[model samples]
Target: MSKKNRKFLATTVTAAAVAAVLAPSVSADELKFTDVSDTYADAVNFLVGNGITKGVEDTKFGTHQNITRVDAAVLVARALGFDENGKYKDAGFTDVPDRAKWAVNALVQNNVVDGLSTTKFGSYDNLTRGQTAKLLANAAKLPVNDGVTKTKFTDVNENFAKYVDALVREGVTKGKEETKFGANDAVKRGELALFLDRAKEHFGFFDLFVMHTNDTHAKADMGPKRATAVKELRSEHKNNLLVDAGDVFSGTLYFNEFQGAADLQMMNYMGYDAMTFGNHEFDLGSSEEGHKALASFVKNAKFPMLSANLDFSKDELFIGLQNNRYTSDYSNGIYDGIVVDVNGEEVGIFGLTTEETPTISSTGEVQFANYVEKAKEAVAAFEARGVDKIIALTHLGYNDSLNFDNDLELAKKVEGIDIIVGGHTHSELKDPVVSNEFDAPTIIVQAGTQSKYLGTLNAVFNEDGVVTSFGGELVKVGDFEADAKAEEILAPYKKKVDELMNQSTGVSTEVALDGGRDSNNEGNSSVRHNETNLGNLITDGMLATAKTINDKTTIAMQNGGGIRASIDEGDITVGEVMTVLPFGNALAIMELKGSEIKAALEHSVSADLRDDKTGLKESGAFLHVSGLKFEYDSSKPAGERVTKVEVSEGDKFVALDDAKTYFVATNTFTAAGGDGYDMFGKAYADGRVSEPGNVDYQMFIDYLNVLDKVAPAVEGRIVDVNPAAAKTVAE
Candidate 1:
């Protein structure tokens, strides 16, 4: 990734603090297991009434006692129901002193313990404040300290650093002073009562908060400040949502560990509502196995895996991937959309992957269809079921030129879709890019790549199901304090990823990437418009990697959108590279007649369907490419916009003939004529490639990191062919 990109990703670290107090309730209900004479009656009653803690004996309420480490574990495990699994039956520990045997087995079986020095359980050891905080926070599944970033405790140094800060954030623990954690202090039974009480308050309420982390690319651990940031969001938002926008497969060596199983588990613990699959979801190298692993990972999903475009009717992998494994359980997608009653309002969500599956997905036996067609069908289905307040989860990128009117067009054409919470392109829309698709307007958003930013949207819907007013922003992952609960959930993965991301790659001259549009005199900027050494390096890598299969390959064309990220000028790591190129999109070379190529060129120049409603600069796929050069005048009418065209051979521009056939390399999206490149569609209605992976964003970073300095300047690769003097070319 570029230094600017890394800096951009790192900019989210500003932490904010909020005060959270345990709200009280009035109830005189008798405690079933406790007598009125119990010394801990008030504390126990308060906890039991709020559903926080329960009694262990018929008449004895252990209140003033210093709870044993074993006792604390049991209370926490039972409260969270962590001991129900049969997987911990063989759990063995040497230091539990038999008296704490049940607690040791329960904690160990639930993955709540880091091995206590090999075979020892350390049960006889007094639980320090730090240890107690960690255990209670994890058991309650609450944010470490309600997402507070850092505290000012004088005594809490880095040694007890792990729990003091996190526990305080989650409201589970507050150390002795501004500078002291009192790490050796024992947590009394009454103190535990307070922690459990707060957890119960947050859990029992219906207030909902939704969080999402899309296109993970197998990084598994939080990227930069993401883990900390999302955790904070959950704690701050109170009711929360954490989601992945698919593409969780492939990318790093972590996937090699259980084939992306651990990543799914991490996401589950982080609490995802629903995740939409990206093309990379097929990268187990086996569609069936990949599907099975996906199912297995979500075996204990608190949410569902929603995908409406690709029909899994014949796929063995989706045997029972729906909600609750019920035959008619369309609870999430009764109308091709899930209705979530968040804070009392209903939120309708639908999901669709880019229809470019034959080229991008390794479905083995799975078949895919056109996203536009499926989206139309799905939306129609939702409409039929009275779900008008719709949000589409799309994996399609935003292209300025090839405007066959996909998502952007859908934003305008479709009527019910209020927001398009999009993934795939990794384009960061800091503000909602309002789509004039309907009278109500569609709010579209994307949070670049990785877990760098949390996209937030607030829509005010009237009783009519139309968006009355809507606004959204991308919150940098570093801006909020890490949510303690999220931290505890991700702690294991974070450590593992730290070991993986810390290794360096190389450095560069300057920040070398600009992902959006280029506004310079050439219609593209040096940093943004033309392919940088980074884009060239990536495209070149694809060509080099693919040539191992086809020596006959001449020129390769990688869609700009598919080039996910740039290699920043700095130390690079394998994980950073994968983040850029997360998908397994491979290279494909197709045979096209020169006439078909001319048609493709024409489609690109005029692809920007500019009308008064949508300004000239608003065409979705207006950007062109490498290997070819083109010029156009928007002043000219549509179909007559281009004035000249040329292809480069070595360093010289060559005139082209429309009758000859040539080999071209590109991805399945453009090849399928997705952006109104009908000539390509007509020529290769059956066009295809056999490669299973694309270098994606990370490959470009890897390529750049290998080269200490990069020079990414745009060369006039694609030129225009004018209509006024085109007699030299055939009609």
Candidate 2:
């Protein structure tokens, strides 16, 4: 057979396998077959008992006879749950006899078999070993051979090479010998029976299928679609696990209005097994109201909220929320790890949140330990309990610029973890990153943010609990139809959010206010790197709000990382504004010397300026200024990157006087020195900052209300002295 022909046949058999849905088991003792080898007698009896075959006679079995094409089809069809008595129309093969028509028609209708020609069934033609391997491999729906390129058997044609390898990988069949499959050799009755039996056992083996998502950020629209995909995948595979890598809060109007209720409801509907806390999960933890929101989200979550490194012992809000505490023994709840039985095998799972949560979000009284150290303890704990396969549910990000403990680093430093489902960087990895730096294979995967994609990883583990073969793919949630149940659950929350979303903010923009993180020269809208129109609009709001109290507040700055989304050109609604600035941060004003401002700028660009060969670095701390301008070079050293700084004075740009104190406006997150801005943190601690009691998004709304039409563009507020070098850094 040609490669094209083999692919066509494989597709046919795979479809048949999916439709068949074979039953649990069949008793081999019920079958009595004569003239069978002792090694193959049980296998032949298994096939006979399943109605896949019958002896040549009641007392005699044709174990030595060459299996025919029709014989092979009947066995495969029966193994795949085809009933001979079913109402199947006669296949259009003219040469097929009526006695064998049922089996041929069933296989043909399911695309498992094609006629030898357009009209001839070729029912009597002897089935070859290569052909038998192809049929059995396809019927089992075994993963396609990835590493096997050349044929293991010299006699096997390239067309049948992959099929043979797949069969070998599944332990269904080895070649007739070590290096010779005897491609054209006819399969005897006993040998065919053994192949079918092994194939059935291969299907019975427990393979783990994990469907995961992360960083949904309250995109409730993705809930129903993601539920649909998870449902379909769970139905298709056994021993399946569904998980979330956290960051389900703080992005759109849904989170702002419902306070993660809608997102949690959706997750509950999807039946998540486990979840970890992302930094955004702690975004609403400053007051009782914020703590209540988090408490409510945790109360409603049906699954365990895992975090091994967090010391929630000192926190009252999370008094009873700890799933499992770190100790020699493990229970369930918010613990270091938990072991769940997956098809009779205990799968140990643990969770890890980034250690930088306290500095980035309002993680009050929740001290965090080193992720790597905690991970080691979790692995050891699981292994002590005889659990060999361990999975790490983490929010450490894929690779972050802040030199934080990321997933890739975790995989390298840790020894026992088998898989790491991660989030926080919002990276869309089409392929799972396989790292073999430790004792076992560590597969790392993260679906992109906002519920746009659903990641599925199927892994086959050996008896020792080590992964031997793996396959993964990201299922696009947008491509799937929304589940009615998920949508119904979200209806009430949607109505409330819809009301707030439709409220017009009384501002229209001629161009989109871009807040994306991509490095494009068109608008430089990625607030993480350079000045953006949206950033300017936001800081202008802060400056205007601050000026109400102190007229001397000349400079306004906002962290690029704090700006979430962009607004397209047209009528802007309150919902769009909320989506762009969903953290619910309040406006703050602070007094800082010109020299202090320059030092802050230097700290802001330090991550990007420090070249560890990662190219252009992005820091959420990268300041977007309204009344100040500065230029930096990527080729310069980290602390000395900012060469020139100036502030706007009476419609004219003047050099910043290091000795002069100026009032500056920014969000409380920045004023408190979130994103590693230590200077701002120290200044705020010294009573140089004052709270204006204004919500950040409300400030933007008030600022926009004064303008009939708003169109802010990126100007020379932020200049890269070496533009070419900066582009390299961005790349």
RMSD of each: 21.3, 18.0
Candidate 1 lDDT trough over 10 residues, lowest sum: 1-10
| Weakest 10 consecutive residues of candidate 2 by summed lDDT | 1-10
Model 1, 305-409: lDDT tens per residue?
Answer: 666666665766566554322122343321234665555555667677766545555666655666667666666666666655566877665432122223575
Best by lDDT: 2
Candidate 2, 464: how far from true, in Å?
Answer: 0.7
Each model's lDDT: 0.53, 0.76
Off by over 4 Å in 1: 1-212, 234-242, 256-258, 285-290, 323-336, 380-386, 400-405, 479-540, 544-553, 556-693, 696-731
Which stretches of candidate 2 lie above 4 Å from their native place? 1-206, 325-332, 504-535, 539-572, 576-731
In candidate 2, position 279 carries an lDDT of: 84
Q: What TM-score goes with each of the models?
A: 0.47, 0.55
